[model samples]
Target: MRRGWICFTFFATLAAMTRFSIPSSAIAVNRSGSGGPVIVSIPHAGRIYPPEILAAARVGREQLERLEDSWCDLIAGQAADRGATVVQAVWARAVADCNRGEGQMAPGEVALPLRAQFSAPGRKERAGLGVIPTRLADCGSLWRFPIDRHGLNWRLESFHRPYHVALSRELARARARFGHAVLIDLHSMPAIPAGQPGHGARIVVGDRFGRTADDRITAAVVEEVERLGVSVTRNQPYAGGHIVSAHGRPDRSIHAVQIEIDRSLYLHPDRSPDHRAVVRMSEWFGGLIERLAGIAPGEDEVPLAAE
Candidate 1:
């Protein structure tokens, strides 16, 4: 039995180093809802991979898909039913991660024009989880060779930039309709292994240690998730990402918060969600959105300047 498990692991890792052909297209941003104060950004839920990317990739489809926050779109999609705007990327994160900043690249790495100013590389980037991932967990490297400048540029222009543009547009629309807007960046994390420090926490709420969002919003989210009988944590393991840092401006009345749900809550072993689990989680998310939408903008909150 031990030998069989070892062999399976080996083959899975080997399989992850191949490629799969896919249709050609830029990143697709699926949007819904008329207008609301809340906007949900599910940046890592995308599964589509352009053929060009697949052709150049050293990793297989399974490994790339493993990087996804699987089924997060379905959870965040519920926000739309509550009249909140939803912006989700359809291009896989391995191509270009919308949650990572442009400058989160390794030394000598080439990429597109900066959409935002540079910030110091974060833990994720250092761990090979950047705008364009260079490696996968358990499977060492993701690329057979360094990506050429032109290919990097294509990913930036075709996938990364478009995803951010759509998200910004939705935020702008939400702010225009409401006095202020709050962005709920939805994601899912792997379950904590037994005996880990955060093993008990099923949800993690990150607001960049209060820099990216208002305290009231974060507190309310923690409260909501805990009420559902899920363990919750704050600013541990995760504390927001590039999306929250870029768009969160509480003083500007544009708050952003990152919510990380434990994958075990909704996903099966294969990373697909059971229908009953999905429905239950979706209902919980819908209620959470409604509550968040009702939060009155703080005195410091101000409408975004006309772009």
Candidate 2:
């Protein structure tokens, strides 16, 4: 019995290593140099999970699907066609969340020293939605067993680091070309349950309560979404995450704002996005990007009357 158990463990570990050995091209960048100052970042829309990660998953596929910002990449792609640079992650967030901060590992989760230094844990880390997530909302925990530091480091180096590097490079390029850059971190939120106070809101714009972006830019985004007949809120449940905090520098003319669309608007009853709804949302997003692009570098920092 002991010999059989040892053999099973060895084979499982071997399979994981073999699957993870291949280099992952997890980030896709599309730049058209159409002179647009906007860069759309879709970090959570990925659906691909590497075989090594899949082997460790404790949750069912459906539960993992819930973590994705479904069809968000498609919506961002529309903006990309209209001259906006798009940088998106292709690896599933369950494997390595690109939006999370680098140091957001759970207490004693992995025992390896990272090559690069990282900051202290953030709120998401406390909630189990860290850089390498341990749990999801409906599914308690995702990993069947504790992963070694080496495996964790591989995920960070292969998927998480590359995604951010591409995003940073795109932002720098946009800023250099246009004298300013507006990073629209696109995401989707789960449907608001019945009887929620802000249930009517279809869109949530987060600028970290005016810290990550200029109030004028935030106002412009809110107004645009409201014009499309979608109720909008600012900095309620989610007030932007690590992406916005790390990249946004209004003083330097680099602004980052997170936009969260209610999944109910585009997703059908089965959680798959309706093509027609996605088209409409994409159109709306395209217009929003155009409006943002028109804002001059200095104009965004000014306090608008609405604010």
Candidate 3:
């Protein structure tokens, strides 16, 4: 998994201008919710890259684009017209990955003294991709200099934390209104070889090995995708990530699932998103959200309070 299971094959170096746009806000929240208990989360599709972050990168825009879900927000937003609240991160993942845990880090990327705070870095982190990405594919380490405690904390407070806070708040609201909430954490992935050995899956639905969502929730997702005539798989290559682990609470009647779509399905070779492909996927996803809204814990199931 490249950076918490965002599968990325070696990205051919590409040339794009420095992304140094700083909007007034870093995230977008639509708490009003479409019409149901569904909340759409577009965590990895952000493109905003402040000047400071651009200056720190050792790779080009193409490599950084691999970090993005690449317009995944559009698919979620287009499909969310049916009563789903959408929480989107406008800040690029190159700045701070919204899908990773706050403590997850690559030790070597942080200054030595600050590195002592973490006894172990996850495999992804050790590979130089973590909450604050330090490496990419063959490009090696991303930063020229190690991040200090101040820099690390600033990235979390400024970008990562707020996105999670907004997502959690919206989940709480959706649950309060409908007695249960469903979070569809949307992401995109490089294509997996079909009819081959390992993962022939194009649509991978992850519920953290069923720890984050109920069996019924995950089942519905698989069924819907299968209905679309696309190959889907369970938690093999990706069993969800921090977003699902942290926000998903089936015991609390809040279900979360991370869906990884094949970029080749909608992304053109030139790197632009195909409009028709996006619409078809959007229609399918919109229906999936609607279907999930009809599902909730049975009367025998007791929901715990959200902490």
**Best candidate, TM-score-wise?**
3
Residue by residue across 83-170, what tens digits does model 1's lDDT show?
Answer: 6777777888888888887777664233234423324556676677877887877887776555445455556766677777777787
Instruction: Judge candidate 1 against the unseen true structure and give its global Cα lDDT, from 0 to 1.
Output: 0.75
TM-score for model 3?
A: 0.86
Per-residue lDDT over 133-179 for candidate 3, one digit per residue giving the tens place of the 0 to 100 score: 88877787776667766557666777788888888888898888888
Worst 10-residue lDDT window for candidate 2 reads 298-307
CA deviation > 4 Å runs, candidate 3:
1-24, 32-34, 193-198, 299-307
lDDT of 2 by residue, 193-307 (tens): 6676456688989999999887778888999998989788898767898899899999888899999998878888787878998888888898888788777755543222221
Error of 1 at 52 (Å): 1.2
C-alpha TM-scores of all predictions: 0.82, 0.85, 0.86
Clashes of each: 0, 0, 3
Q: How many clashes would you count in candidate 2?
A: 0
Higher TM-score: candidate 2 or 3?
3
Give the higher-TM-score candidate: 1 or 2. 2
